[model samples]
Target: MSTGDGVDEVAEFAALLTELKERTDRSYGSLARRLGMNTSTLHRYCAGEAVPQDFAPVERLAEFSGATPEERLELHRRWLRAVAVRQAARPRTATTTEPEAAVAEAVLPEAAVARTAEPEAPPAEAGRADAAEAAGADSGGEVGSGGGPARRWYRRRRTALLAAVTCALLATLGTLSALPADRSPSASSPWPSSSADTSGSAPARTTAPAAPRPSPTASPNRSSSPSPTPGGDSPTPRTPEPSTSGGTAPGDATVPLTWTADSQAWALGCGHDYVVAQPPARVPPPPAAQDAGPWAAAQGAVHGRETVVEITVQGRSTTAVVLTALRVRVTGRTDPAPGNVYAMDQGCGGSISPRHFAVDLDRDRPIARPVAGNDTGTPIPAVRMPYRVSSTDPEVLLVTARTQGCDCSWYLELDWSSEGRTGTVRVDDHGRPFRTRSIAGLPRYMYDTSARRWTPYQ
Candidate 1:
């Protein structure tokens, strides 16, 4: 399999498929026969020329090759990534041409409109129109011998009407343009006034006082007190600043950073261990690591003793934002969740050298502590904040929060500053606090790869 920098998912998927087929010592024709597909079709899939719409064939092939559970899981992940890329790359058919065509017809001259409308004409009628035009041109601008005078008269009338329409349209546009920028056109005007507010409310001022500077030590949950203006009057209501090309305005309530949190991140080189309330028999077999989030939810599972959340953060604009700190706010604490613990993978070993932080949820004041690589034993220097990120440069932080004393419900607050504005962004599991329950002394189970069943962990 392709590894390390600049890996193409589609190519990696195809490489794995080719590797599996080669391990089985199977030829394209032989595998195709078994897969109920043509040799060429199978070859295309293995060569990365095509991705299968359904995963059934790929799964069957893996089983036929006697792939280990981990290998199968990796294969599935690669396939999913490849399929997503393919779907996103597919071209969307244009379905919005009619509105543009109407606009073109509204502004074009009559002759230009007629020419533009020709493509919509019936084939036979369009052919005849072209022939008539050719004949008129060849005959020195005459329609025919007897009808030349009548045609000339009709053409003159048509030209005069077109000129009058053009002049009237231009005058209307000029009148609209001459109107004051702040004034809305009357209701009787031809075009709807975009700036007019139909609601019978007080007109909003065009400008407002600048917002007060945010306190650096302000609590994330505490609302800031409004600052008084110099005239001792209540500060004018702040207007929302227009979004800048870099991102949302700094004073806006919305954070300028965009982030994705993966709650199923690998912990200490092992797959996620979820503490589900269901019994081993009632709960389904553990899914692959990538699908763990949904599976854990369906089983009503919380993270085991340690929950490693991988968060990828980047600024929405080109402006560099420095991530100052990550703070943990505990919402609740209780006894360990009562249930069985399900481990998604058996004993597995790997190295994770990403920039990571650790949180001790049992502590009175839990703070994210920068940590070195996990499982490798070799200690690397830990780089602590502040880290800079931009639209082009994203940073990934792996946060592992462990609780052995009590179950904890918590979320993270990321403090960031850019340009002279600082703000705090709350990060949680889709608006809900992340829950991690102490799995100590709980019944533990692991999927036995050989038997393909959940078994009690010794």
Candidate 2:
């Protein structure tokens, strides 16, 4: 081992792996699972054992580790060095009593190192060569000249370009799937095209917006409603009243309405079949789907990907609320949202074998994932609320209600994400996931008909 002039053979090898894991922000467990190896065994590999000659799992692990493009190439280089050393004969470094020497003793056991090479060459010598190469480089950023800022920037750009191309290919496939069953024009249809929004030439069909599910409400029958045709029957209590372009009320039109169980609330899953209204806080006024005044209008654009929808009731209504289901898309990336995508595998309340569901921030439905931090592995309880418009196209906030633990708090944005095509979840200072300073509303509580009780806190 040498000082500034040379790099320590053992230290450099270990540091490379450590940095790779850090930059990828991947857990050893996740890496192992992706590689189809026992998690404990994978941890041992990450601990600096030589890779087995069997490289299938290793290759896949490299793929999903979320490394930048440059990092992938580096991984390949490091792996090649590891294999080269495995094929060679290596001597065990001496264990010594001296403090500095003791530091050189690796906690990793030699037996764990993958022995893939012919025994003629020694691994110790191969490792020595690798170290010499690394130290000779001016910086750790580049392979030939040492990794410098310019080199690092070039590597990053290359990686991003590759990712963009990959995303584009996937998008093209997804675009095809987004289209309707048939491309034929129907006399009653307006938007004559799917995958494209050019429909001004289509027929004049009354397009109604989606209806929102209220939090908890005394209006027990509000969930379900019969679809209404404008010129038909007498006015009913729960018709889907549509707002005209001019915001004018209809005097001669009598709309027939009916209530049906809210399909949107049940979107959460079999058990969570309810919306974010967990227990209703305040009974909302009529038309929970109204555009309302200027307050409800969107102001600007968000950086990442996002989706917004509106709902309206045909008859008299006061309050407006939103229910959401959230999901993110960044191929090969794990959601930054905390708490494992809100899987209630055990069943909501207490049903056995309920269907698995997640909070897909990408959709206009109601489910959310809760997450914990590095120090705490326990996931937080969270759900998706309606995406509000304070700014334009913002990454939605996936709010979790931690009724207890770490003291009662209002909402935990375990992970806030947008649809910008960038798939990473961003965390802020304190290493805590991103959070907003003041969430809009106060805690509103209500009763759950299924639970037959009231939630204790917000």
Candidate 3:
């Protein structure tokens, strides 16, 4: 209560807790609901009526309030002090019989011997018992003149308590010593599942990438023959569109290949299974083993995590189109692309799962468009195209989709022209395209399939 130079630690702690609750702007009911605890229980915590034995709820509440590191640390220290004080105030009672008997049996063989040899006293001894009581009354209830039994019992009990306390302290120190330095007890990391997302708000219109699913076979199957790889001759011909130029045409050799992208039109979902920079292995992790951070609000929006897509052109040519102008669309007019897949436990949960479509230069050929930001389970009505690069240039043409929010696996398709040659590369981003990007393309950091580990893309 004092406003003087000296601080009231208990009052200050209570005030801090109260301030944190107010800052969250959420009613006790809402907080309790999200945390799955009773409102009065949370109230008791904020009121400082009693310090909680477990700090899990406190850590969660701190995260919800978005408390800074310093404030969280201070609050934790306050709780520790309160718990220590409360524990110390409790009265201590010890039963001397058990410990004393054990010590006597171990250290004094004569004590056990005397117990076994004891028998009923004779009638004449009854007179001696009365006389012995009279002497004992004068000696203040001591068993013997020196009170050896009482002294021995007290000494043994004190020693046993001290030994137990020492063992507990040693065990605690040993456990702490084994933990990693960076992973010390703190507010930033309450547990493996309780890490906070400090990435902040991501660029608008980003979707949490889902676990890499099977490649769309619709597009590749439509073509009678296998689609030509990048830098190879295209079996299909380039059918030019009507020329807009007074003397030349839009699709003519004189005009460069053009494409457009409506970046804002693409909507990303908040709930995705995984977000890895590279393609996932053919044997995907089991449903239970998948990382589900995207579903957690505490981890923040999955769209916030950036996925980098890089595009590179190897052969130089004036006929090349703007790489960014291309849009993803279905390859066929009547073919249905793979529908938007929802992550496990995310059905109709307000996540706008993006639809996968084959990327092409043409915009109006039954392309799959992104669904409304609020809708879920909108069937992808277009073709799901695998990752591909098309170009005619003898030199290598490269394109990197340098964006974020890719799952542990994803898809990409690319088409381009160089050196008067048009070639197309089609493959799954989770497969060869993803591997080439790391092996021969650029140097970047990607999450490995291993649990909580990172590996270099070389």
lDDT of 1: 0.64
Model 2 deviation from native, Cα RMSD in Å: 23.7
TM-score of 2: 0.27
Q: Could you tell which candidate, 1 or 2, scores higher by lDDT?
A: 1
TM-score between model 3 and native: 0.25
TM-score of 1: 0.45
Window of ten residues with lowest summed lDDT in model 3: 258-267
Number of backbone collisions per candidate = 0, 53, 43
The list of candidate 2 runs beyond 4 A from truth reads 1-14, 24-26, 90-398, 401-458
- Where is the poorest 10-residue window by lDDT in model 2? 403-412
Per-residue accuracy of model 3 over 5-111 as CA lDDT, tens digit each: 11244455556666666654446775688677899988877776666777677766665454545456566666545554443345434643544444333333444
- Point to the candidate with the largest lDDT: 1
lDDT of 2 by residue, 151-250 (tens): 4444565466456545654654454344322112223422223345445544323223333333453232222223333333333323333322112224
What local lDDT does model 3 show for residue 384? Answer: 21
In candidate 1 the C-alpha lDDT for residue 323 amounts to: 82
lDDT of 3: 0.37
Better model by TM-score: candidate 1 vs candidate 2: 1
